[model samples]
Target: MRCVANTGRMSRGECSSIRAASDVGTAVELGAVVSQWVGRVVPHEGYMLAAVDPVTGVGCFLAREHGYSQAAARRLIVGDRSDGDHPYPFDRRARQSRVGVFNTDAPGLRRNEAMRDVMLDQGVGSELRIALAHAGTMWGGLVLLRPRGARPFSADESVQAQRLARDIVAAMRRYAAAAPPEPSGLALPPGVLVIGTGGGAIAAERVVAATPSAREWLDELGTRPADALTTSDPPVESIVWILTQTVRTTDKPAMTRVPTKRGWIVLNAQPLTGGTDVAVTVQPAVGTDLLPAMAFWHGLTPKERAVVEQVLEGLAAKQIARRLEMSPHTLNDHFKSIYRKLGVSAREELIARLLR
Candidate 1:
């Protein structure tokens, strides 16, 4: 018995050691991934990695080797824009720099340096900014800095940084999928299950088409349309609400709402899944009201309305294409027309104007 107990203890120690080593390995892998783009920029003396909360318009520093601390980064990126009650201009210039599009040659970096002093009391060296945009919002960003006397980012470096920015965004998406849903007030994790007669088929087809992985689980279900509808965990409420309210529809496609702990869970059910398949989209019922803007935005042409609605809901061009059965290039054209008519340079401005 003693011998067996000793052996078990040894096995447990080895298991713990292996787990620790695995964690260290993962950290190294993440570092290597970032390192791949270092020289592609301006000799990369240091870098800042940050994640943005789309809903709150907040940026959180995930990692940084630059002089700025997390608090400093957040304050600088999401600082007050009011300028003492005089309304700030709505142009792209008004928006503070978060991560992408930083240039050593431009005035933006000079402004950032001034703000850095007020917020953090530190000055950043020459740097290149790159942002990770997903689901229509800038979710993460990277800032690669060079010490004094280092070369500014060249055109080639900027292009390489953009490519690296894309990888960072992809990594964040994977992280979000793997991370467990945080605690919520609801009994179940918020999710929408679509159900309807012909509606269910249409909705299911749309969902499966939009999310390829959904097909794997949906394929195992019965073929009967009604059988599929019957299998929905939650009964349908309002079709218009589910379609328009939950999943913000664009002329091209519909997008899933940003997941939240306290929000509505929408599900759609219809006989056919050919059209829009979003059965449910979760939205906050209490504090924020997006319906007024959504109504106005949806009043535009199906295509125009779709683009506007997705913008209001905070989805990016890539996500819109997936939901709408169109290419990103096509969606960009639609956005150009939408912006022209609305007289807005960016989606954020359009949303802010409509919501007001």
Candidate 2:
């Protein structure tokens, strides 16, 4: 029950958090902080702070202005970006330190009809966006939208937003790091699922590969594809909670995160294609440094990964060769290549790098 007092001149859109659990308390707090910060800075309709992972091409909004609808907010959080060329102002143009402003009536935008259409379709009169970037990576950005009939943002307001962009990026960065690495050994289909209005499974499908993190999430829900529409579980209850809150009109509850001993499992539910059932996506919050991520980065082949995994187990060359069904000489070749590509000197360094 943290209180978000007014921070600046604009003193509107302040609301109390109804989420009781602390599983996502830090992120919720970050949202409250950013939302309040935006409110204080300008007298706009709403603002959203988004965290984007350029490596994964996944983006999330930690805080969204209160006036947005749950359906719209959910789409923004977990929907497809290929809908059209929208007003994603914080793009490569702002990859450095530039702040972006998108206004429907701006004369400069008369030539870019696509941009104008996006703004009109969104029913927004103006917007402010800033991309959070570091070391050539675009982590994410912030966007403030003013609805139709509202006045366009003044230059000072844009400057004020620019000043806060870096701090907001840092805030999202800390929020992402707070989730411990995914620490479970359960398996399930990819990150997608379909839930009924009552929070029971309707039909589930895979959008990502199954991993221990996904399995543990299903275990938490006490659910599976077979249980679709059959019964409700604790996890289903939580999903139902979010659904109910979303329907409350005032609460902009778009997503929920479950805290675990090792890390965080996030659940994103949206209305399915037919609008009768909700689709839920499950994912781990922190696991970017794991084997697959490292292997891809280090350009390791399947054989290299197998050999490295064996080496990390303290197996000697003879045993590793026998187990891999390769001769001792052949095993030595892989070790040499692995060492060279990974910039490691010996098996010890290889294991150290992998474990890290």
Please report, in order, the local distance difference test score of every candidate based on alpha carbons. 0.40, 0.51
lDDT of 2 by residue, 10-122 (tens): 32222112111112444445655666555566555666655543343233334454434434444342222234344443333345544656677853223155445545666
Q: Roughly what TM-score does model 2 have, to 2 decimal places?
A: 0.48
At residue 112, candidate 1 shows an lDDT of 44
The clash tally of candidate 1 reads 31
In terms of TM-score, the best-performing candidate is: 2
Instruction: Give me the overall lDDT of model 2.
Output: 0.51
Model 2 poorest ten-residue lDDT run: 14-23
The C-alpha RMSD in Å for every predicted model, in order, reads 21.0, 12.0
Cα distance off (Å), candidate 1, residue 168? 1.5
